[model samples]
Target: MIKIVEVESNKDLKSFIDFPHELYKSDPNYVPALYMSEKHLLTKHPFHHHSEMSLFLAYKNGKIAGRIAAILNVNYNTFHKDSVGFFGFFESTNDFNVAEKLFEVAEKWLKAKKAVKIIGPVNPSTNESCGYLVEGKNEPPVVMMPYNQPYYHDLFLKMGFHKNTDLLAYLIDVGSFQDKSVKMLDLLSQRLSKRGIIVRKVNLKYFKKEIAECMTVYNEAWDKNLGFVPMTDEEFEQMANDAKMILDPDFCLVAEYEGKAIGFTLCIPDINQIQIKMKKGRLFPFGIFKLLLGRKKIKKLRVLALGVKEEYRRVGIEAVLYGTLLKNAREKGIVEAEASWILEENQMMNRALENLNGHMYKRYRIVEKAIL
Candidate 1:
């Protein structure tokens, strides 16, 4: 018999967080998330201040068979004006019965909360890692991206979920990519300079102040995106703190006009190469050394985010940021990078990436079901 149990105690929560590590143990491409980070996110992260989430685990014959989190993102509904709840942090074995039972319980919980529709695999929200690997099943995921077994897609389909949208991941061969943007970077910089807008690396020295400035640009730049909800101050700060551990100022840039931050782009080393070697994703005893020593050896990056204020659009800031980031990555001996989770409908940015010879290599989907 399959049983679904709400994760109410510390032990159950541990099981919920650790289930994926066990489920993907035999998979070569699996990269385990850090245990401590997962704990904080589920237990005490700032997201909990404004949203509600309940975790559930599926047990079969006294062993964990699957796990999921039913979330009601009040902020998301308030901003988007939709009655949609979310199911996230999902993991399961190959058994269809187990997957079905897990989703059934999660949907029941959301239905009781009066949610009319359910959408996700959003590790709680779109501002965080979400989606399922639909196309890129052969390779390991990049930093801050999601990955899962091929069977998970089939499982979602069988459970009545349908694709809401596909997020695109583009691979750029930086070493071989030759674009006019790079060639004209100097001219672009000069034009921006004449307008008193300058692009430069993020000031890690004033990290807190820099983050605060960038937050303004970030919230404004992405406010109009589908499924976007402006992150509260606490949420953005928590993310910045987590990112600082892996941040390289060289790969993060800011665009300033008259000393006011107007835009920013952030890329981080694809540290999954190091994390994949971590057994169980523990950071103590030996994992810390691997992370610290392995960073410089990482040869790939992910263009995690890039945003410019609406007024600054069409001013070549985007091209300048991408050009400078590529030049720096090449100088650092980085051969390849992935700019991912780009919305399929974002034609301008998509075209810009293609212009730089970026190949759309992987696709992920956010699935949804009408529960009402």
Candidate 2:
């Protein structure tokens, strides 16, 4: 027999966070999320200011069999003008009944909140990690991306979730990319310079100001993407603060024209290389030392965010950002990089990545089902 329980106590929540570790113990590619970070995102993040969520766990024979989060994102609804709820942080056993019961509880919770439809795998929002791995399960996920058992897709489909859209992740070899545009980097930079545009490493000293401008570009650039809703000021800043910890200025580049920030790209070291070694994603009892020192051993990078303001699009600024990151990654001895979670419909950016020989190695899907 299976029982579904709402996560109410801190103990239950810990188990909720830790369940995946046990679930994927034998899966070599599973990278456990940092326990503390997951806790903060669940309990204290500013996302809670505009959304409500409840975590549920499915137990069989008194052992955790699965878990899910049912979310009512007020901000998303207000922006999209739809009564859509979201489900995320989902993990489960291969048991169909367990998965069904978990979704049933999530649907019930969202129905109470008047969410007419349920959509996701977005831990809580599009601003954070979302989607389930439907392709490329052979490798571990880069930092801040989702990875799941191959059965996850089947579970959702069997539960009546249909495809909403897919997110793409491309892998680039830092040491030897096609680099068809490598020769054009200089020409692109010069042309932009003629227009009073300059590409430079972000100024950590002026982080607050720089990040604010980047957020402006971010909101405008991604405004048209499917399911995108502009992140509130507080949400962007809170996320920036966390990124600041691991940011290397060289990997965070910005393009400005006449001192107006218009385009930027953020690539961070793949700390998952370090986190994977940390037992249970804990950063204590020597894990901290490994994290700090192991960073130098990190040879992979994830192009977490890249965007150009609408007016700046098609002006070679995008190529310049990639070129800059490529050069920096090589200098740092980075061997691999991934430009990820691009919408499948984003032809221009997808083509640009493909031009540089970025192979689409991973695909993530976000699905939906009517609440009824």
Candidate 3:
């Protein structure tokens, strides 16, 4: 018998967070998320200010079988003017019944919230981790990217979910990126300078000011993306605070025009490299040593974000950002990078990355179904 239980207590929440650690224990490429971080995201993240979500666990014969979170993103609905709910934090055993029950619970919850259509696997929202791994199951995911068994795609489809949009993850070898692109960087940057746009690393001395500028660029640059909802000041600040720990100033770049921020790219070390060895995602009792000792040994980074103002597009700022980051990465001995979660429809950015020899190694999809 399968029983569906809502997570209401700390004990249940802990089980909800820890289930995947046990579920994927035998899978070599599964990286366990930090328990503390998952806790905060579920219970206290700023998304809660404008959204309501419920977490549920499925148990069969007294053992946990699956988990899911049904989210009503009020902000997303208001911004897009669509009553779309989302399903995220999904995990289940191979049994079709368990998966169906989980989605049924999610659907029921969303319908009660007045959602007309359901779309996701967004782990809450696109602002955080989203998508299901439909391709590229060979290696572990890069930082802040989703990874799961190949069967997940089938599971969603079996439940009548259809493709919403496919997201692309491109891998760039730091040692072998297009030399022509590298060679033209200095020239292009110089040309951009003539237009009053200069490319430079983010200044840590004015960290807060730089972050504010980044927020501006981020909100403007990504506003047009599918399923994107502008981050409130609180949400951006909260995310920035968490990202500050692993941020490499060299990999963070900003494009300025006459002293005004126009574009930016933020990359962080692929911390999953360290987390993979952290033994169930703990940072104490020697996990701390493993983390600190392994930070410098990390060899890859994820271009977590890159964006330019609408008027600033096609002026070579994007190439400069990529070039500066790649050059700095090679100098620092990093050999692998992934520019991930790019929308498939973003042809210009996709072409730019492909021009730099970025290979589309992984593909993730957000699935949707009309609920009304």
Identify the leading candidate in terms of lDDT. 1
Tens-place lDDT digits, model 2, residues 1-372? 899999999999999999999998988888989999999999999999888999999999999999999999998889989898999999999989999999999999999999999999998888899999888748888999998888888888899999999999999998987484566788989999999999999999999999899999989988988678888888889988888999999999999999989988988899998888777888888888988999899999999999999887888888889988898888889999999879999998899889888899999999999999
**Local error of candidate 3 at residue 59 (angstroms):** 0.5
Locate the minimum summed-lDDT window of 10 residues in model 3. Answer: 175-184
lDDT of 3 by residue, 268-345 (tens): 999999898877787878887887889899999999999999999987888888888988999999998999889999
TM-score of each: 0.98, 0.98, 0.98
**Candidate 1, pairs of clashing residues:** none
Which runs in model 1 stand beyond 4 Å of their true positions? Answer: none
Model 3 bad stretches (over 4 Å): none
Better of 1 and 2 by lDDT: 1
RMSD of each: 1.0, 1.1, 1.0
* Total clashing pairs in model 2: 0
Question: Which pairs clash (backbone N, Cα, C closer than 3 Å) in model 3?
Answer: none
